[model samples]
Target chain A: MTQPIRVLLAKVGLDGHDRGVKVVARTLRDAGMDVIYSGLHRTPEEVVTAAIQEDVDVLGVSLLSGVQLTVFPKIFQLLASKGADDMIVVAGGVMPDEDVVEIKRMGVREVLLQDTPPDEIVQTLTRLVAERGER
Target chain B: MSRYVPSSELVERAARGEVPAIGRLISRAEAGMPEARGALATIYRRAGRAHVIGLTGVPGSGKSTLVAALTARLRTQGLKVGIVAVDPSSPYSGGAILGDRIRMSDLVNDPGVYIRSMATRGAMGGLARATLDAVDILDLGGFDTIIIETVGVGQDEVEIAKASHTTVVVSAPGLGDEIQAIKAGMLEIADIHVVSKCDRSDANRTLVDIKQMLTLGAATSAKPEWQTPVVGVSSYTGEGFDALTRAIDRHRDVAFGTASGSRRQLAIARFRLEKTAENLLIERFAKAAVTRAPALAERLRRRDADPYSLANELLAASFERGSAHERDHHRPPHFAEDHW
Candidate 1:
């Protein structure tokens, strides 16, 4: 039997706004993927540690606290240090277009904007994991 | 990601408490990959040194919060703790939202604590098929205490009793009538009972109700060696946790020290053996049925055969094919080869 795609949805930094992340979590679950939510205000280190421990197919970081530029890079560094850089990383929540480009440059495979529909979020995550050939 | 790593190397790293290695081994076990069988066998052999505790309760009973509090308490004693938290999978999507870690976020940064969240993935009895394997992995990783937290379960999910050395059942105030515990069959399996949300005034009713039920049970049953204690704890104020821990420690002593302890061990072994065999049989049957089921369904639709006879025919054919495949491979069944 094929294993379901496992995703870790983390709210890194001091982001107390979790409504968006919760919606995305439900969206992913409805689309047949296991979503592990690492509640609000997690540091980059804590998030990466959980993702590694979970051995999830994807690590999706949700930030509404405007720390994406600083947080995503540290997460990638931690993942690399732990020999888990092969795992796909994705970012969601509010961000400027230019910041999204920079975040993608930092090795985040996908940048899901606030306007990205629920269907697209699911499809994008599914396609990303499929491309990684991990599931 | 599929690149092969020698199980021996992974086992060595895991034995030394390497976090990433432990995580990888757990993933392999959860996926039921054949390559992980050898590593799991090694893990199982190294396990049993750690105390296994199972916590079960209905939804919203503060189980996850209690686990966090309990882990912190155990850590204060310098004990290394490992937690396996199970969450239910959605029946429609076969997906799950494993939010147990939300309550456990504080414990993540501590090196002495390791928490893994599991999706039940359609397994009944309030646990994932690989839950015990993950527990063994943690035990092999040199943890002092391993806690298995089941999904907020309802009646008849007493499988936790067979898997844990000590089973703690949590009941909260205002969920329903006080007799919900007896109705859920939790009274029989609980080694220690906990009334969470004790800060609430109505919590007294639940506590009183459970105490009354225990009294009734004790009167009817013969004198027992170990008495189950009811603990009222408020995860918010941290009240009653010390008492809870004391009860757990005392029970562990009884479980490992007394003659009844040996009997409990035998029961645990029997349960594991039966569960492993059942899982293997279902898996092999599914594989064998894939090719034959379509034709059988067609026959049934055409009224050429009755359902009972066709089912028997399918079972016989599947078993025959299973044995033939075993002979051709010149190996024992996968479950026996891997687990035993």
Candidate 2:
């Protein structure tokens, strides 16, 4: 039998605001996926390490502290350096449209803004996981 | 035919202490994939070598931090550790956001430690059966110590006390009196009562309260063979770890040193057997009962028949059918097909 999708939800950088990530955690959980949430103030290295160690199918980083440009790429580089580039990485929390586009260009599977509904986040994650699993 | 059969390659890799292979095996177990049973069957022979320690307490009780600290300490002593953190699943989605991994990030890069998060997945016990299976896999994979940190819901959490050889129930300061740790019935199951975040001013009072409760409780009414130690620990500062480890070692020596230790082992074995049998029996019979006696449920719902007698009647019918099938070589297609 195929394993259920496992996603790691992390807050990267100085993002002490975690209310959004908590909601996403609950939403994904309600959607019947296994989610591992690494709490706030995590460096990119810490996030990548946890994602690989946990063997998660996807990594969703929430960054409300406005460092997505630097954090997301560093995370991608770390995932590459650790030979975990195959892990699907997504971004959420507060990011401007232009920065979201730039971060997406940096190998984020998807960028979910703060306005994205919880259900939509779940749907996006489900789709991303399924798409990745097929590969 | 076997429901699921683990690949020999995967089993071999896990047995050789390959991290990814062990992670895959644990994932299969958590998902209740049929082949997981076969994998566990293979691993079970090599398990029972590691000490299983269970940690439980209320939310925000510093369980994850303590686990990290303990893993660090154990590693310093040249012991390999495995951690299984059980998280509560959402009632609506049957999914869980397991956050325990976040606290132990420092150990993620260490080859001496392995951490996996598990969702309850609607299991009757506080922990999903998969959690136990994962622990066994970790044990067989060469972890000297396995810690099963549980999500601390009230009554359901009692199962952890039974599942582990040593149950450490953690509490912190400022939970208030009416909702104190004692009121949660945690004291009954605690082999070691850990007061975490000892840096708080109220920490001393919480320790005092725990000591007072232990003294007053029935667990200490008589001159007990071993006294339960309430140790204060601050996971942040790493204070009191020596005392905590000593307490754990002392308890382990006395518990495993005596005849009662063996008795406790027997009890755990019995629990495992019963739980597995009960789950299998329910899977086989519950569906069969619904199909054969659809009206039985309706009648009971209408209060025409009481649950006690109805349960007895169902059990009798189920047993008779089961025995007849076994003895006479008769089979019910639907009965055998419908299993969770």
Candidate 3:
């Protein structure tokens, strides 16, 4: 039997705008993924720790506080240190196109802009996890 | 990803309290991987040590908060705790967002405490079967106590009764009808009834109502049972936790002192055995039924055969095969095909 894809959604940094992440979490859950929402006001360390402990297939960080430059890099580094770098990392929330490219360059797997539809986010996550192969 | 580890090695690592190994083993159990059976067989005897506690209540009754507080209190005694927070899966998607541990962020960093959130995944029981499996793994991993928390509603939440030695029913101020729901059936199964949010004015009323119901239940009951204690606690104000813990300890003492604790153990053993056999029989029957369902359906649609008789026949055939597999060496060839 195949396990359902497990995804962790966290609000990293001081950005309290969690409505978007919560909606995405609900959408992904409705798409047949076991989602673990880490809740709001989570630091990079806390998010990475939870992602590793939960052993999720994907770690999604939704940050609107313009701290992705610092938070995403630290998260990626921590994942590598914790031997979970193989897990897919996706970022969402308000972002400039250049920042999205930069974050992706910093090892963030996918960046869904604020304008992306919830269904699209779900589809993208499904496709990314599928591409990463199975357990 | 740790599936490559042999079952024996996984069990060995889990016995050492390796968190990653335990997580991997539980994932295998949840996925129903073939290796899980072998792993469980190796670890099952190492279980039965952990105190299994079941917490259930209506939504927003602060069951999660109470669980966190109780866990923290237990940890202060230098005991390792494991929590299985069972949440509901979406009926449409068969998926869930397990957010119960969000209230216990402080315990996240505690190595001695392990919290795992479980989605019911359409399990008929409020507590998922996988939750029990995980609890076994945690027990084998040497946790001193394990807590299984579920959002209790309607009749299904009674399933929690089988998962723990002591079942704590959490109710709080407000939700008068929900409290009534608890009184309808849960009051009977509860070892300890907790009225959380004790700081609220309605707390006293809720306490009085629960005590009244418990007293009423005791009066009408036929069997001798442990008297259920109702404890009022406010996790927010950190009040009544000491009393709550003392009540839990007293209940444990009474249960262990009498035959009720052993009865709970027997019930759990019977439940696990029956559940496994039930799963196996259902799988075999469904596979056999598929080949004959179309004709059965046609007969039913045409009113040539009533559903009750057809269902009985299906059940009879399944049971006959189930019994024959244990007793007889030579089996008939294609039993369903030959008969149908």
> Highest TM-score among the candidates is held by which one?
1
Q: Specify the highest-lDDT model's number.
A: 1
DockQ of 3: 0.47
What DockQ does candidate 2 have relative to the true complex? 0.38
Clashing pairs in 1: none
Interface RMSD of 1: 2.1
For residues B1-340, what per-residue lDDT tens digits would candidate 2 score against the true structure?
0122244556787778876667767776665555456667778876888888989888888999999998888888898999998888777767777878878888877888988888787775568768888888888888988999988666446888777888898888888774463444787788888999998988999899888888777544432666778999999889988988887777676557777677777877887878767765665465558555677778899999998988777766565644433343223223353332
CAPRI quality band, candidate 3: acceptable
* B1-340 per-residue lDDT for model 1 (tens digits): 3454566677888899988788888887888876678778888987889999999998888999999999999999889999999999999998889999999888999989999999998899988999999999999999999999999988889999999999999999887664564445899899999999999999999999889888888866532768989999999999999999999999999889888887888999899999987887776567658767889999999999999988887776556634543444322234353332
Docking level for model 1: medium
Which runs in model 2 stand beyond 4 Å of their true positions? A1-4, A13-20, A63-86, A93-117, A131-135, B1-7, B179-184, B217-225, B255-257, B285-340
Please list the residue runs of candidate 3 whose C-alpha ends up more than 4 Å from where it truly belongs after superposition: B1-3, B219-225, B254-258, B285-295, B312-340
lDDT of 3 by residue, A13-64 (tens): 7798999888898888888889999988887877777776666788999989
The first chain of model 3 has a TM-score of: 0.95
lDDT of 3 by residue, B70-153 (tens): 999988888899988888888898889888879887787778988887778777667876888899899988898899998555
| Decreasing DockQ order of the candidates | 1, 3, 2
